[model samples]
Target: MRVPTPRLSIPDEPSLALPRSFWKEFARKNWDREPRLFRGLFQAHFPTLEEMFAALVDASERCLRGEIPPMRAVRLYVEHEDGPGGIPYYSMLFPLNRNHLPVREDGNAHAYLERVTRWLGGKRFGVILNRAQCHHWGHWLQMRSFLSGFYETVGVPLAGADSAVFFGNYRYTPFGIHKDDWHIFYFVVEGKKTISLWPFEALSQREEVPKEPGFIHRAGAIHLRDKAEEERLLSQAQLLEGRAGDLMYWPDSYWHRAEPSEGLAVSASLGVAFRPPEFVGAVAPDGWPDRVRHTELPGGRDWRMPATLRTALQQRMGRKSLLALERERTTEWVRLLASGAMEGAAPVLTEAPLSPHEWLLGSPARPLVSFPLPEAQVLVSANGHSRAIPAPPAVRRRLEGLVERLNSGAPQQVEALEEAFFTRLTARAFSRRAFRELLDELVRWRAVRRCEPPASQRR
Candidate 1:
């Protein structure tokens, strides 16, 4: 007689989807890749995932005082942009609310606003969210309580010793394949996430994937290795069918995706973020278990850059500056385009246009016209060769003059600037996209400010 396979039962009330052993199978195949302290720590149940969701809602509510501070920063990713963009991609980022979000309408949401701002400023851009202002506070509290139990359940501490700020993230939409560098705990408060795992070592040997929209399509067409290795890696891959009260523990460098199937779905998650330890060893020391110490800093600092070219460069070009520069630049660029300076232009496919005017002069003769941005450098010679250029003395002088005018603070004659810049080049030179990027960079660096032009200059 044939025996029936156990149907994965989900409770009518809030509950977890699978048994602890299922996750245990996943940990066995992947644990060796994690730090020793985190090995064998993948138990599926804890403060059940439902409880964790409750805690998160509770914390957000408690933190909400009257008149919530304006969301200091917010990053929005709509379904249209990221859905099939290739392995969890993001399009736009607003590191500061001034450039992106509307003014704060309520006072109670202050603490939530503050913590989110800190996270965005710190560059944790891809954290999931069900909505910007979730209305359920009790749900938040339950989520937090579950996290406390998670710490108790797992003997090894997942978060760093000094880290005080707890991070909460919820996955609403299905995320494509991706990986993160930090250590994270994912509690499924509601709905289900069927995750697929890979060795990550796979990505290391194969070619690196590009973030561009078109490039990813090309890569997928040429390299289709998923099927051959799916059985080996995916077979051992554990599915954390998280229901209302289930939590999935993943160590640092875990490569996985949260996939949604056909069903009504909702889930709350929390990521208690901390820095990685400074040193690596087969075994962790008492004080350095996960490796780093984190501390909650006092009230948020004004990382927003003040406008001054010198200070702007120092901050914009520095290692520490977050998205501040990028946002500022984007805002200013928008303003420039609105002024009609860069009309009917296409972004240069190569390194920055040799001359601002050259963009307006998109000529076929200047085939060496393309230059690669830092991220696009590999592709520069991939098609095989770099081109040679020979500019006459008059052309060189004019180009130099164009750069000086652009860098100058004085007002420019828009038409004149265009002609001088584009005169020698072909007509297809100007690009709205490139102009926007330059303006964004300028605004980010504080070289330009956003607001109405002075009345005297408006006409």
Candidate 2:
């Protein structure tokens, strides 16, 4: 993504307000084209105003103390660019383990809220509670009414949704460009989230403008001492600033970043990241099929005694020794299978069995550029079943790397690869079920992209 340099350093100005008419038109277009991000706003309130605020305050205090991790564990993550005078900001994850949290007196949330307010300079704070732990903090007690209003307005069913509630504590933080797996709606419960969003296709267009003495970003922004680069890149982007009580509807594939100015700000937001029912099958290789191959896979080895085997007979060892030797053999098999047959490559397949598509058929591969948008119906009928043709080599390779990095839990690797995938691809690609599934991993990391995958990536 490119960042353009302004001919002038317009000092940080207060957020600008837009007329209702302007927003009405802007929102109508987004809703017509993509409903995933903009849906579920304007619905009835959930958790009640009082209950939501109290929980947010309690969670923020715990986050600042490092008692909770930002995404899962209370670990603070900060990324520093090449520029000087850069500041670090903290982000805390919500839904702390109920079992792990210190049980409070009668679970009085108000006292905990006060303790957090005093800790953070007595100003308001921000928070994001994950769905998994929402119930632990007494949030689920009122979830029924909260969701009822949400479903009524959004016109979308709320059943089986795994959601997270997000609130922003007012402080200075520069969140760079990024994308997310689920569609999100930013409802101003309080405060504001000033956002800058770019069209996914902007990367390929690389709009042109006069050179100036500042920074410019476009096709992959690089911070440099040169001013000429900054001016050209900024011209191609569309900038939007949001304020209190304003709802920002972002398309799934749009790229955006947000930073809250210094003030007392608060907001309640929820998002549903959905996957097809068909995808509910075994979780990759960890399910039933892989279990059958456990003995063959490498990693476990400690005890086993084989009798009447050629190698076992040659060894001629005692019972204890034989058991130890068997354990070693088992462990070796586990490691070999996990690491894959190709040296230097990790094991990516299970030997026990594979789904029909993976075992006997391959995708009707095509050049990535040729696939049609939102309906790349490349699948062919074989034995009365429809099968998805595999993506082209390069595309599949990139996705493969994404699946691996996501599982590895490497922050840097996940961020870099995801940004490239969202910014460089077309809108159709983002709407596809497979691509969306790959992106859901990033959602777990707590990094939100302002948009969904491009239409080009959708199936």
Candidate 3:
């Protein structure tokens, strides 16, 4: 008997079809060779790019209201074509603030957005928003489901992964030639981008190329300005152009650069850090027994013990072991891929619900509290099994306040509760999804009940 496979919840209207065979072929051909490029691989995956752009604009407004942590969620850069070698130069590095925009006051988010959009339309600069999962519920759900499907299909252990949205102008290349440490899956939502890639080994061997510093995260084009050097490299470069809905993958350490063509460009990039089977033991060990007991471990097992022990071990044994282990694992994985052993299996597809933001907007507000009985506190229990879970102080306080408001016989407005209470709370502001998850857990624990609005107020 064949075992039934579980399905992923992907978006319905703008459906996605994974190019499993293409990816498998890619793995077979260039897994261990120099960097390669594939053009127009997924030109029909996302058709709602405009809608997503509108959602991003609204999210940016919410971010300015202190409803979210701006710095951690968004990055803004102004690019000018005046840098060395005539490449675009970046201003306002990481952790961007309102001051980075052209607006006079931080409160004028509308103006800031308008100016930024205008700049992008004129091929002036670009912006990047990180951790998009925290800002948009629907986007987060789709991304999580897609990632799950990708990992299951590929049969690789994911170390770390994240989604970021980028908005730029035509002919804009924010960064010069550089390489990232993580594999990237680039999805174009609007406009087009041309990518040029060069092998790291080939670039490193050129006498005119300046040596990169050990601590530098990305090597830029400042050192490769000579026309002779640029021409020589271009002679052997691989070029790929991608349009809206197209998907492209770039392996780690592949030196490449991108420039938008035609009009304003908008795209999403999913960065993935994979752990080969051999490295899985070092990176993610199976310690469920210890994990449970440790949670049961009284007083948190001297919170600093793990770090202190790790420091001591590293000093005594040297960092060579960890480095060598990583190198060996990477090589092994590359060999498997080159030998056609790492091709992803055919995936099982399923329809996913609309994102959280869309669902909540369409659904009517209802009271989630069932019957308030006791004061809120961190709960701890022990038997043959022991468990301890602490409620965040802010959430506990909010629950208590909700109970008070309900007991006073005042009618509660759902909109007020979401915006005034949940959104305004700094701790909860970082993630709407987490706040909603907490509500679900409360309902399951009999701490809250779904109360519908009166017939007169129902929409």
- Point to the candidate with the largest TM-score: 3
lDDT by residue for model 1 (299-352), tens: 011112122322433444455343444433323322221111111111112233
lDDT of 2: 0.35
- List the lowest-lDDT window of 10 residues for candidate 3: 361-370
Per-candidate TM-score against the hidden true structure = 0.32, 0.36, 0.52
Query: Would you give me the overall lDDT of model 3?
Result: 0.45
RMSD of 3: 14.4
Candidate of highest lDDT: 3
Task: Provide the lowest-lDDT 10-residue window in model 2.
Answer: 363-372
Candidate 2 deviant stretches above 4 angstroms: 1-29, 32-49, 57-127, 136-163, 168-175, 204-244, 277-459
Better of 2 and 3 by lDDT: 3
Question: lDDT, candidate 1, residue 243?
Answer: 53
Candidate 3: tens digits of C-alpha lDDT, residues 121-227: 54355667665543444454345444433543453333345567776552544655667655677777777877887766656655545576531223334246654
TM-score of 1: 0.32
- Candidate 1 residue runs with Cα over 4 Å from true position: 1-74, 81-90, 93-175, 209-238, 262-264, 272-459
**Candidate 1 vs 2: which has more lDDT:** 2
